[model samples]
Target: MITHIVLFKLKDGIDRDTKQVAEAVAYAREVGHQVPELVDWRVGWNTVDRDISYDFAAIGVLADLPALQRYQENDFHRLAIEKWRLISDWVVADLEDQ
Candidate 1:
């Protein structure tokens, strides 16, 4: 299996408690539940506060690279990512779950 992970940092002046951010979070969570290629999904805000910490995280476990690609191409995944794209900067990593 492969683990796909993303971390997000909120843009300057963005407030996580606001309606927009909350809605984005809800939508992202739905994608976690709905994406077919993902064997497991987890997405949420980071629990710690520190200069080096990102504000949010999304993690997905899939069968392999093609499955990971399908997860990325899923429509809901695109929409959920667009929501955060407007409000934050993000980074990703993919790992082999051996």
Candidate 2:
């Protein structure tokens, strides 16, 4: 399987408060539920005391590289990512079966 992980730093002036942050987190949490290639998904908000250089995270599992690619190319993904782009500085990595 492939594990796709991502972290996001909110753009300046975007996430104005805890409510905004919660909404953004909710959006990310919906991705895997709506996308087929996503076998599993988890999303989180930063709560550690350390400097929050990043505000959000997404972890996803897919069956293989092709499945991961398909997830990346899907319209649902495009829309979701575009929404994230307005609020985030995105970072991502994908890991395959070990």
Candidate 3:
């Protein structure tokens, strides 16, 4: 299995409560349900206050690299990413389960 994780930090001057940001967060939380290749999906806004903490995070598991690629290529997933791109900078990591 492959675990795909992402951390998002809002861009300077963007309000976290704005419609775009809210929708982006919601989309991130729901994409797994829309994509057949994704399993065990989870996403949320960060509640902790730390200088280095990102504003949001998402994690999902896929069966393998091809599954992960399919998830990335999904239309809904791509739209969600575009929304995030408007308001934040993000980083991603993919790991294989032992």
Candidate 4:
């Protein structure tokens, strides 16, 4: 199995309380249900406050690399990502379970 993880920091001047931010978070949380290739999906706002911390996180599990690729290419996933792009800068990591 592969674990796909993403951390996002809101861009300058983007308010965390805005409707757009809420929509972005909701989209991230729901995309796993929308994309069949995603085996598990989890996303949330950060509760801890720290200077270096990201504002939000998304974690998902896929069966393999091809599954991960299919999730990325899924139309619903792409649209959700576009909404996130408008509000944040993010980083991602993918790991395979041993």
Better of 1 and 3 by lDDT: 3
Model 4, residue pairs in steric clash: none
Q: What C-alpha lDDT does candidate 3 achieve relative to the native structure?
A: 0.92
How much does each candidate deviate from the true structure in C-alpha RMSD? 0.9, 2.1, 0.9, 0.8
- 4-91, model 2: which lDDT tens digit per residue? 9998988878754756566666667788778899999988776764674677789999999989989989887787787777677888
Q: Candidate 3 has what TM-score? A: 0.95
Give the residue spans of candidate 3 off by over 4 A.
Answer: none
Sorted on TM-score, highest at the top, how do the candidates line up?
Answer: 4, 3, 1, 2
For model 4, the superposed segments whose C-alpha errors exceed 4 Å read none
TM-score of each: 0.95, 0.85, 0.95, 0.96
Would you list the clashing residue pairs of candidate 2?
none
The C-alpha stretches of model 2 lying farther than 4 A from their native spots are 16-23
Deviation of model 2 at 50, angstroms: 1.8
- How many steric overlaps are in each model, in order? 0, 0, 0, 0
lDDT of 4 by residue, 1-98 (tens): 99999999999999989999999988887897899998889988899989999999999999999999999999999999999999999999999999
